[model samples]
Target: MFAALSEKHEHKKVLPDLEGAENGVVMRFAPNPSGPLHIGHARAAALNDAYIKQYGGRYILRIEDTDPKRVDPEAYEMVVEDLKWLSLAITDTVTQSDRLHLYYALCTQLIERNGAYVCTCDNEQFKVLKNKKIACPCRDQSLETNLVLWDKMLTHGFKEGEASVRIKTDLNNPDPAMRDFPAFRILDAPAHPKVIAHVYPLMNFSVVADDHLLGVTHVIRGKDHIANTRRQRYIYDHFGWKVPVYRHYGRMGIEGVVLSTSQMRLGINDGTYTGWDDIRLGTLRALARRGISPDAVKNAMLAIGIGDTDISFSWDNLYSENKKIVDPVANRYFFVPDPVTARIEGAQPHTAHAMLHPSDASRGTRTLEFTGTVLIPKNEVLPEVTMLRLKDLFNVKISWDNGMPTFTYAGDSLADARAAKAHIVQWLPAQATVPCTILTQEGEMSGACEPAVRSELGKVIQFERVGFVKIDGVGDDGVVAYFTHK
Candidate 1:
């Protein structure tokens, strides 16, 4: 499915090659398993996968599950599911929790070479020194003393927040965050979900170490991480290791949507959201539930490309892209929203044939029994309307008598209706119609649709003049569908 969509965009644009990647390219998408994969995360994943496919290189799915406080085992599986849904072919998988020993060993090596030191400064003390643009007192600690403190951190001799190991960087650097940043921090082992190590390596230290050890030749991340890249470079320089080629794209966000994991967690706990898959949320699961195709997401992100300028887009942009993909395949059906029953005078019981798809006649047709009584959308019935054409059926002269709609056969030829400028409206045989509920972004809409919709469960269909919708399921009472887009 994804391969077909990717081919559509192949000729639209060309992506630049990674600098110094002529030897070979190995890219990794390391996501923290604190929450489900959201739209912003999808952009990164898709871009990396595209590069891997284009260059015929390896792609790795690395779970950055080191953060004990926020990590959820279920979220790890959800991330993998989302990647597979995006059709990302991950050649390797690695979980950081299983590599605690490797990080500790590297921490020891850094301390032994005086490249890092353990800082025991309290929060207030460090803030005071940081505000003064001066190095903390621990920066002058001897290599032997720092190593002893580091061992204590690993041995549980110090409590959480009591100490942390800091990498040696320029104290007078313009960016204070880059000055002696924390390499390893003590976590409450009893509170962690997986690993019980009290000392956990921070992202700055862990990612650099894993990238080199895991043979990641190219690193693609958001431009917001430019500072972290500079800090990681110092680590590579200290160890005399070659740094991976870095490609940082500008941050992309959906307008009016917040993708913050912390905020989402709070909303779920506070009952503002049902879960990560809530339709209002931006998580990939949420998008999937709303009938948004993974191919649509990939193509949209590919169009954005890698740039330094921040990009913000409205949901309409996504809908437009999705419409192009679904329009050709989705079958058409008559759906009357908030319908009103009207009796057709001088009408005969006839069988109407509607093409399953306007463009693809090979899909065949649907049969509808046209009885005297029919259901028409309440909104489409205009007060001044003299004539209306039942889409793919016939024209009817409409009249309002005693505030009730009365329909009389006008003609069967579409040419006459088109010449009369008659409104094209959708209608369903009242007795043969089936109940339907459409779940939209705003709220749920109740209506009656052609009985043919019931059999289209798990299929996407166009509701004639209405928007595209996916039939989610069918129960004894009604058929339920999710609105994709117009």
Candidate 2:
């Protein structure tokens, strides 16, 4: 079964080689501190970490936190924690907020080199002219005048949106929006979490300055950033800096969960979501809480590779990868949801010993003592099904007395049970059951589980007829667990 499950993901595709990697590659995973990193954000991170691991190099973690309105103060730590959970190592960490001075110096130099200008034109009016392929009046301002305007932008001489710095690109470029784009802007409201500045550099400008300054050799990001990459390249050419090798994979469309960080934060604020690790959200915190290992995530991502074609995130592929990693060691147990007790007639007290693992005998067995009664899931009982085999125990024929279910003991031979077409089901003795509540994506399911389940706390285990789950808590009330996918 496991072999067939794994064969589905065996594709002939392999990851393409990184250009100029022989010169000691230096890669970075730069994420905006808006919210916790979602699974959609892991592709870039995992690929960069993989390259760094393959070819020894510096892996930098840059927190792009320049947009104050979009920034979440708590997300700084959350981003780091998420990456740590993904096991991506960083040789150095840089916060863009701390390096505003660097961007300012470079902006000033770009003005001096005639690579940029301070545009005082209204945004809408400039767009009208730009769409017509006409340069705004401020685009031709002298270097000295532009420098003075830039100083005003820094010293509150220019109020928010009154003036901005625009990088000088080909005005005749096919894409009008790409012509002389805004590199820096003034925004004085909603004080930034880390820095106190009215003027801030946009993504393209800041990314170019930081990547060049930090000596980043490769930039691996989604194809959605293709326009941004093109804009950044103009900056690199203007300053005559070596542009890094670029590899842009297609957008990863993850289905069946919310991946938008902003939407998740809104849900969390409105009480629609419990937290970052709410199990239904696509954040890494959610995956970790449900016992999905970092290696499984990484392996699943690597299998997808850095392909340019758009792809959806496959939950089946991830579950298959995870099952391969967790199946061999996950102990087996019995749990009954919405349990119903069945009295057994003509049956003697017996001890049933089941293997901890189906094939690993050395791991030993769990001894369950039964006294002519067993608890089974209510859903498994049916009027038409007469005989049922309580797995690893004797077979019993279902009967009704006083409108309540009863079981009459039959022969214990496995072959006889098969001949009777008795459906095997997981059952637990009433004497040795523990209350269990599993937190699933849909909701919580309460039931009775075998006592041995308590010993598997803080580990992943499979219930005999149900899916795998991670034991999260054991308290006076009951055992609390998070249900992982089958």
Candidate 3:
């Protein structure tokens, strides 16, 4: 799938060949309103936005809300919100629900012309003949009978399998989807007020007819929709309607990480994840939580290089790319989690000074006080001995016994400790001790500690000898931190 998307997308910049190419271009970004938008949707939205800006055309955001079984008003609203948050400007007037009359009119025309009919077959019957070529029982129903039943659907109620208006396409065809295809099914969709009269298909035929009405010249989406394109092509052929140019791209998949909406919901419900923003997942919240910028995603897509073919990418490449962009600007801070405090043996107390961003000084510098002792996360490393790093600070001297050692200010003051070329510096105070909260991947951890040297809030900084830290927020208790390593 990735290969196919690559080859076709290589020439994506070129104008697609279509019947109305002379009239100008009108492409549609039609995503189903099933769940909150994910990274995959973001890419498609980005491509659509870019296309409209580059080409002489309009990009229509058509809510394929035709799938009633899976629609959620919250998810639907979020789709728009997420796209807009990513800096996508979409026209507000384009939604499939707004044009339901067109879909119904087409179904009515097909039924009257013997191109469609009402099917009385239930799921069991349909399944039995799914593989075998079977003619629907109501295919030959009088147009008057179908019209009356259709009215019943609109005015009263439609029972399950009571009637389905199927397009009278080739019944002998091998493709089960197109074999006597059911164009509309009676649905009690919650998003739309429960109306008994309307029947909808599985998105294929509906999009084909509606795109013509809305003047959509092109269609770009995931490869999963390619088969639907084939079915839609058949409908267009039957109606003698012009088909839109289609470009399918590889569905973005994170390496070794199968993050889906279902997985996310399950994790949240089971207490395994904080919420949709869990860093391990791919939702917008997760990206924001991980401190990944929106531009990072867009640039990554560009760097990965789009194609109308399927391509599998390793996560390391993305990680490396992000690291390159962040290395120069990330501020330096001191963060020690599950902290264990140590005092520099009899060192004079003084304030520490450090640059926020060691490589890029424009961010300015911050002051931290090393009252004499420093705090460090109690991990595999022992904090009670020599050879300690102020993290982003220089190495310090320590006085040790058989195994344990008292702290010594072998390194510079807080400022001097961080003034060197090192990448991280953690502040330990020689002053009073206080209870501290440690941030970990699993959750918040608690411990006792002294002031750790840090520059600013909501910035990415490395502990001189500790782990990476993200300042969640500052409070009366202490600053909230999240550890980031890989």
lDDT of 1 by residue, 305-350 (tens): 8888888855786787787778777899988999988788887787
Query: What clash pairs does model 1 have?
Result: none
User: What is the alpha-carbon RMSD of candidate 1 to the true structure?
Assistant: 2.5
Q: Worst 10-residue stretch by lDDT in candidate 3?
A: 447-456
Residue 352, candidate 1: how far off, in angstroms? 0.7
**How high a TM-score does candidate 1 get?**
0.95
User: How many residue pairs clash per model?
Assistant: 0, 0, 45
lDDT of 2 at 433: 90
lDDT of 1 at 168: 88
Model 1: runs farther than 4 Å from truth? Answer: 1-11, 269-271
Off by over 4 Å in 2: 1-13, 400-404
